[model samples]
Target chain A: MLAELMLSALLLLVTYWFIVTRRLSSAVSAYSVQSWLLGLVALALYVDTRLIGLLLFGLLIVSVKGILIPRLLRNRVAFALVAGRETSYYVRFPTALLIGAGLSLVGLLAATRLAFQPQLLPQSVLGISLAVFLLGLFTTIARRDAILQVTGLLAAENGLLLLSLVVAPGLSLLIEVAIVLDVLIAVLVMGFLVARMRDAVAGTDTSELTRLRG
Target chain B: MIDPALLLVMLATPLLGGISSALVRSDRVRYALVVPTCLVTLALALTLIARILATGPVSAFANWLYLDDLDAVVLLVVVVVSTLAGAYSIAYFRSDAQGHVLRPGELRKYFGLFHLFTFTMVLATVSGNLILLWTGVTATTFAAAPLVDFYGSHEPLEAAWKFLVLAVAGELIALLGFLLLYEAGIASLGSAYNFSIPVMEQAGPHLTASLGAIAFLMVLVGFGAKAGLAPMHTWLPDAHSQAPAPVCAMLSGAELNCAMLAIVRVLSLVTPANKARAGGLHEALLAFGLLSMAVGVVFLISQRNFKRLLAYSSVEQMGLIAAGFGIGAPVAAVGALLQMITHSLAKSLMFFNSGNLLLRFRTTTISEVRGAIRVAPASAILVIAGALAIAGAPPFGLFISEFTIIRGALLNHAWAVGAGIAALLMVAFLALMEPFNRMVFGQGRGEPLPARAELGLGVLAPGYILLAAVLVLGVWIPGPLHSMLVGASQVVDR
Candidate 1:
C-alpha cells in the first residue's frame, strides 16, 4: 500500500516538473520517465496481486507510451522553435510547481478526511491522483505550442490513468490498447497537422493557427 | 438474428451513394440519388424505430449495441433529420459550385466522407462501450474536417484545422477521463477497467471516490467541447457557420447528442457515496450549462448571419439539455432525453430549410436574404415551424420538454427554477425574435431568393413530420415511453 501511494506521488511530481520546466527535450524526457514509472506501478501490481491482466496493460503502457509515443513526437515534431518565451502563462513554473505541491498536500488532507482503512495505497493514492488531475489541467491551459499542448493533453491522460488505477482497477488490457491506439492516432494527426501548420503559416506556433478568431 | 444486415446497410448506403454521385459527374444524377437513398434510410429508421419500440432494446454482437428505448427515440429523430437533410442536399448541391462542377473524383470523396460521418454518428448512438463511442466522435471530427475545407480555400481550410485541433484536443481529454474510469477500483484481478457502464457501476463502491469525481469532471469538459458547452464551445460557431448546411445539420443534430450521451452514461456509473460527497456531477453540469445558455443567448441576440444565429441556438439548446441532466431527478432526466429527440428533429429541419433559402438567395448572411415568405414559401413555412418549435412554442415536444425541465427545477427549488426559466426565456427570445424580425421582414443587398431545382415534397415532409411529432409529444406522454423515461430517470441519483 505504501509502495503504491509513494508511486502515485512520485508520478505526480514528475508530471508537474514536465509541465513547468522550459527545456523542451528535458520536459519530454521527464514525461517519458513518468510513463515508465506508471508502467512499473502497473507491473508491480501484476506481481504483488498476481493479476495477469495488469501485465499486458503494463507492457503496453511501457512500450507504447514510454517508447513509441515519445519516439514519434521526437522524430516527427522538429525542434518546434526551441521552446521558451511564450506570452502569458496562468502561473509561472516555480509557482505552478509550488501550487502542484500544495494540491498534492490538499489531496492528502482530503484522503485523511475519507478515513479509509489506511492502506498505504488507498490513503495517499487519492491525493496524488487529484493533484495530478489539476496539474494536467494547468498544463493544458498554460501551454501555447500545439505539440506542448498535446503533451499537456497526455499529462491529463496520465492523471486520469492514475485516478482509474486507484478506482475501478480490473478492467482489462483492452482498455490499455484502446488508449494506446488513440494516442497513436492523435500523434499521427498532430504530426500531420504540425507539418501542415509549418507549411501554411511558416511556423508551427499554435497561436498562428488561430485564423477564425472572433 | 439481430439483423446484422440492417446495421451493415445503414453503414453502407450513404458511403455508396456518396461515391456514385461523385463518379457520375452529372448534377442530374446527384439530384436523382440523394433523395432516394435518404428515403430508403428514412424507411430503415422508421422500421428500426418500430422494431425497437416493439421489441424493446435490440442487442447485437455481444453487447456492442444495446439499442433500447432511448436509442430508438434518437434513431427516429435521425431518420427524420438525415432524410430531409439528404433531400435538401439534392436541391442544395445544385447551387454548390463544387458539387455541380467538380470532377468525378473530388465529388465522390466529399460525398463518401459525408456518408462515413453519418455512419459513424449512427454507430456512436448504437454503441454500448465508452471507447467505441469516443472513436465514433473522433471519426466524425476527421470526416468533417475535409468537408469544412472542401471549398479548397485558405480561410475554410484554416477553420477546419482549428476545428480539428480544439475538438480533437477536447476529445482526447474525454478519452483520458474514460481511461481514468478504466483505472478505477481494482477488482481482485488488479487491472484497469473496461469501457462498460455496468462493469464500472459494479465496481463503484470499491473504487476511490475522489478518482471517480475527477474522472467525471474530465469527461464533462471533454464531451462538453463536442456538445457545445461554453468556455470550450469555441469551435462550434466557426465550424457550423462555415461548413455546408447539411453538414451543419449533422454537426448540431446528431454529433453533439452523441457526446452528451457519453457524459450521461459516465455520470450514471458514479458511486452513490461519491455522488453525495461531490454533489454528483449535476452541479458541475448545471453551472456549465447555465454559462453556455447565457453565452449562447447573448451571441444569438447579436448575430446577423442566418446560419450563425441558428448555430448559436444549438449551443443554447445543448446547454438546456445539459442542465436538464444536471437537475438530476427522474422527471428531469426524461425531460433531457425528450429534449435530445426534439432538438435533433427541429435542428435538422431548420438546417434543411436554411439550405433551401441559401439556394434561393445564394448567400447566408441574414442581411442579404429576406421576406422568406415571398420566396420558397413551402420551405419558409417549414423553417419557421422549425424555429417556432425550437424556440419552445407550444405544440412542439421541445416546449413540453423545456417546460418540464423548468417545472422540475421549480419543484426541486423555486429559486433555481426561476433562474433557469429566465435563462430559457432570454435565449428562446433571442433565437426566435431576433432572426425573424430580419429574416421575415428585413432585406439584404443580394439577389433575392430564387426558384431553383424541383423542391421535392419528400424534402418538405420530414421537417413537418418531426414538428408534428414534437407537437404530439408536448401534450401527451404515451404509457410505454413514459415507463422507459421513468426507468432511465431512476438511474440518475444524487
Candidate 2:
C-alpha cells in the first residue's frame, strides 16, 4: 500500500513536470517516466492480487508505453527537439501549474465522493489517476507544439492505464493488448500528422493550423 | 441458422480489398477490386440481416462477435452507404485525376483507406465485446485520419489533426467509462465478468448505481463527441467538410450512427438497474440532443461553405435521433431508428450532389456555384430534392421519421419537448432549403459553365438509387424494415 501510494505520487509529479517543463525533450522524458510509473503501479497491483494478467499488462505498459512509444516520438519529432524547448503555450507555466493543482484537488474530491471499489490498491490512487488524466487533457489544450500535444495525449492515456489497473485489473488480456495496440497506432498516425504539419504549415506550432476554421 | 463463416467472409472481404488496393498500382485495377468487394460485403450484410430477422441474433467465434436486430440496423446503414460511396469513388477520383488534383499513388491510398475505414466500422458494429467495440471505434480514427489528410495540404492536415486529437481524447475518456462499468459489473458477477454485451447486460441490473451513472455520463460525453453531439461536435464540421465527398458521406451518414449505436448499447446496459438512474440518463441524452440541434441549426443558417452546412445538418439530424431515443417512448425509439436510415440515404445523396458541384464548379462556396441547374440539370434537381428531403419536407423519408418522433413525444405528454422538436425542425427546414435553392437556381456568377460538367451515368446512378430509397422509405416502410426497426427500438426502449 505504501509503495502504491508513493508510485502514484511520483506519477502525478511526472505529469506536472510534463505540463510545466520548457524543454520538449524533458517533457518527452517526463512522459516516459510517467508511463514507467504506471507500469510499476500495475506491477504493484499484480503483487497484491497475484493475477498473471496484471503481471503481463504491467510489462506491456512498461515496454510499449515507457520504452517503445517515447523513443518513437523522440525519433519522429527530433526536429522539434533540435528546435529546443516549448516557447509558446495557450496557458503560461505558473497559471498552468496552479490549474493542475486545482484539477488534482478536484480529482481528490471526486475520489472521495465516488464509491470506487479499489480492489487491492490504495483508494488515493483513484484520485491521483483522475488528476493525472485531467492534467494530461489540459496539457494537450494548453500546449502549442504538435509534439507537445502528442506527449499530452500519451500522458492522458497513462492516467487511464493507472485507473484501469486500480479499478479492474481483471480485464481480459486480449482487451489490454488490443487497447495498447490501438494507442500504438494512434501514436504512429499522430507522428505522421506532426511530420506533415511541419512540412505544410512550416512549423510544429498548431496555432498556425488556422486556415480551416469557420 | 445462417453459417457464421459468412460473418468471417463479410469482415474479410474488405480487409482483402484494402490490402489488394494498396498493392495494386493501377487505379483501374484497384477500382475493379473495390467495387465488387463492397458489393459482396453488402450482399453478405443483407443475408445476415434477413437471417437475423428470421432466426434471431447470430453469434460466432465463441460469441465474441454477435449481431442482433440493433446491430443489423446499423450494419445495414453502413453497408449501404459504403457500397454506394465505394461505387461512386471511381467517378469522383477519375474527375480528380483528370483535374490533376490527385496523383495515381494518392488514388490508390484513398481506396485502401476507404476500405479499411469500412472494415473498422463493420468490426465495431458486429463486435459483441464491449472492449473490442471500443477498440474498433478508436481504430476508425487512425484509419480515417489519413483520408481526411489525403489532400496533404494546409487545410486538410489541420482538419485531420484536430479530428485526430479530439477523437482520440474522447475515446480515452470513454475507455475510463467502460472500465468503470467493468468495475461495477465485478461487484455482482465477480470473476465471471467479461466485457461482452450479453455479459454486461446480465450484469446490468446488479451494477452499482453511482458507478453506473458516472460510467454512462462519461460514455455519453466521449462517444457523443464522435457522434457529432454538440459541445464536443467542434471537430465534426471541420473534419467532415474537409474530407473527400464520398468519405464525408460515409463519415456523416454511417460513422456517426455507429458511434450512436455504441452509446445506445451502453444506455441499454446502464438504464436497466434503477429507475432514477434511467430517468437521469434520459434527461442527459435529451439535453445534449436539444443543444446539438440548436447548434447545428444556428451554424447551418450562417454557413458559407456548402459542405460544412451539410456537416452541421448532420449534427442536427444526429441530435434529433438522440432526442428521439431520449424520449424513451417506443414509437419515438422506432422513429429514431427510421430517422437513422432516412438520414443516411438522403445525406449521402446530398453529398454525392455536392461532389458533383465540386467537380463542375471547382468550389464548395455556395455563392460561387449559382445557376447549377443550367450546368448539370440532373444534379441540380437531385440536389434540390435531397435538400428538401434532408430538411424533413413532406413526401420525404425524414419528414415521416421526424413526425413520428414528434408524435411520440406528444404521446408521452412531453408537450414542451414535442413543440421544441417541431420548431427546430421547421427552422432547420428553411435554413437547409434557402441555401440549396440559391445554389441550384440562383444565377451563375456570370461565368460560363465548364465544358464536360455533366455527370456520367456511373456517378449519378448511386444518387438516383439513394433518392429512390429515401422516397420509398418516406411513403412506405417496407415490412421487413419495419420489423427490423421495431426489434431494434425494443432493444433500446427496454
* Clashing pairs counted in every model: 20, 0
| TM-score for each predicted model, relative to the true structure | 0.80, 0.97
What does candidate 1's lDDT look like per residue over B1-494, in tens digits?
74556665765676677677667766566667776777776676656656665666565655555565565556655656666666656555655532336554555655666666666677676766667767766667766777776655445656776677678768867876665565444432154334554445556666666656776887899888988999888878887777778888888898788788778777776646375574546888888888888888878876777777888888888988888888766677778888887788778777776766666667777777677777667767777777887787777788888877777777677466547656766556656766765675555566645543445675566566766777788788787667656655655542
Considering chain A alone, report the TM-score of candidate 2 relative to the true chain A: 0.96
- lDDT, candidate 2, B92-126, per-residue tens: 88776225466559878888899999999999999
Q: DockQ of each model against the real complex?
A: 0.24, 0.74
- iRMSD values, candidates in order: 4.3, 1.3
Residue A33 local lDDT, model 1: 84
lDDT of 1 at B378: 74
lDDT of 2 by residue, A1-214 (tens): 7888999999998899877787888888998899899898888877977889989999999999999998998888787787577666788788998999999999878887876675776678888888999999889889988888888988988888888777777777888899899999999999889888778877688888888767
- Residues forming the 10-long window of minimal summed lDDT in candidate 2 chain A: A114-123
Q: Evaluate residue A82 in candidate 2 and report its C-alpha lDDT on the 0 to 100 scale.
A: 78
**Which candidate number maximizes TM-score?**
2
lDDT, residue A150, candidate 1: 63
Clashing pairs in 2: none
CAPRI-style docking class of model 1 based on DockQ? acceptable
